[model samples]
Target: MTIKPLIILPDPVLRQASKPIERVDGELKRLADDMLETMYDAPGIGLAAIQIGVPRRMLVIDVAREGEDKQPQVFINPEILKSSEERSVYEEGCLSIPDYYAEVERPAVVTLRYLDRDGKEQIVDADGLLATCLQHEIDHLNGVLFIDHISRLKREMVIKKFTKAAKSKAI
Candidate 1:
């Protein structure tokens, strides 16, 4: 599978809410494969379809740490069905945002309903890093970012930096 170009921060496409896939077909499967390859190449634990300019409610995640067997998972039209009141914090980074990272708080546990790669429905009860990763990607499907969970000052600073960087690249 070929690795797709990641859409970086400050791109308006990254802020658009993704549309749900009408069906999971061969082309969709290929896109998912490409996404997994891109995520691995990015050396990131999670990636959203919007990050890859797909604008679909899809994501790929592999939270397995280095040296462990890669456990790539594809989530299509994912939704958080339930979440715990208890909070957890993780220093989260995004493929779209590149090198920047910051602590973000989310539910310690989440129950998600999503379509698997084959279009089969799957329910997952996730905790720890997996939980955080799932939440982050789902936010992308909804036109949100991990930085949005941070303080306004920090978020604005990040947006400004990326916007300037994007402008420089255009010059």
Candidate 2:
């Protein structure tokens, strides 16, 4: 599988809501494979399709700890069905945002419905890292970033930083 180039921060496309996948086919499967490869190459636990310039409701994740077997999962057109009122915080990072990380609070448990690579529907009740990862990726599909969950001052600072970096690179 090819490792696709990640669309980094300050890209207007990241703010665009992703469209749902119409069907699962060999081409879609190949894209998922490429997404997994790109996520692994990023050394990140999760990645959204929008991160790679594909504004499609898809994400790949593997929350396996070090030394554990990789458990790659693909979610197509994922939607959160339910979420617990209880909150949990995790220091989250994004491949698109690169090195920046911050603790963000979200539901401690979540139930999600999505189509697998085979186009079959699957519903999963997730907690801990899985829940957080799913929520983060789902937010991407909605044109939301982890930074959006943070304080406004911080979020604006981050956007400014990335915006400046982008301008410098263009020079």
Candidate 3:
């Protein structure tokens, strides 16, 4: 699988909502494989399709701790069905946003429905890192970013910084 280049922040494409996958086929499987490879190479725990310039409802995640066996998971057309009233906060980072990280609050437990890699339907209740990761990636499918959950001032500052960085690279 090829490691695809990430679409960084300030790229307008990241703001576009992804379309749901109509069917799961070999090509889609290949794309998922590539996404996993890319996420692993990025050394990140999760990645969304939009982050790689693919406007599809898909994401790959691996929340395994360092040195533990990799447990790569693919979610196609994932939808969160339920979220706990209890909230939790985690320091979240995105591959598209590079080194920036912030603590974000979200539901501590979530139940989601998704299609697995083999075109089979799966419903799972997730907590801890898995719940947070799923929420973050699903947000991407809806054209949302982790920064959107932060304060307005901080979000604007991050966007402005990335905008400037992109400008310098273009010169």
Candidate 4:
């Protein structure tokens, strides 16, 4: 598996909604493997397909803390089936957004339906960081970002910063 180049913030590709996988085949499996490798190499807990310039409905996550045996998970065409009324706030970061992080409020518990690596259907009930991570990644599938959860003023500021950073890199 190879580490794919990340599609960073302000990249228009990231804002495009991802298309669902019509069929989960060997090619898609290879993509999931590559995504896991990329996420681990980036030292991030989760990554979405669109974040890597793949406009497909998929994500890889491994919330295991440092030094633990990596527990990589793949979610394809994931959809939220249920969400709890209880709310929790977590400081969320994205691989695409680099070092920027902000407190985002999301449901504390979630039930989701997704296809596993083998293309088998699976439903999961998650809480804590896992729930937040799932919700965040799913947002990417819908052309949304963690910054969008923040106030408009703050969101605009973050975008402005990234826009400037992107400009400098192009120089």
Better of 2 and 4 by lDDT: 2
Reference-based TM-score of each model: 0.98, 0.99, 0.99, 0.98
Cα lDDT of model 4 overall? 0.94
Which parts of model 4 are misplaced by more than 4 Å? none
Best prediction by lDDT = 3
Q: Rank the candidates by lDDT, best first.
A: 3, 2, 4, 1
RMSD values, in order shown: 0.7, 0.5, 0.5, 0.8
Candidate 2 achieves a global lDDT of 0.96
Summarize candidate 1's per-residue lDDT along 50-135 as a digit string, tens digits: 99898999999998887999999999999999999999999999889989999999999999999999999999999999999999
Residue-level lDDT tens digits of model 3 in 50-149: 9999999999999999979999999999999999999999999999999999999999999999999999999999999999999999999999999999
* Candidate 3 Cα RMSD (Å): 0.5
lDDT of 3 at 51: 96
lDDT of 4 by residue, 44-80 (tens): 9999999999999999999898778989899999999
So what's the TM-score on candidate 3?
A: 0.99
Report how far off residue 148 is in candidate 2 (Å).
0.4
Worst 10 residues of 2 by lDDT: 6-15
Compute the lDDT of residue 44 as modeled in candidate 4: 92
The superposed Cα distance between candidate 3 and the true structure at residue 114, in angstroms, equals 0.4
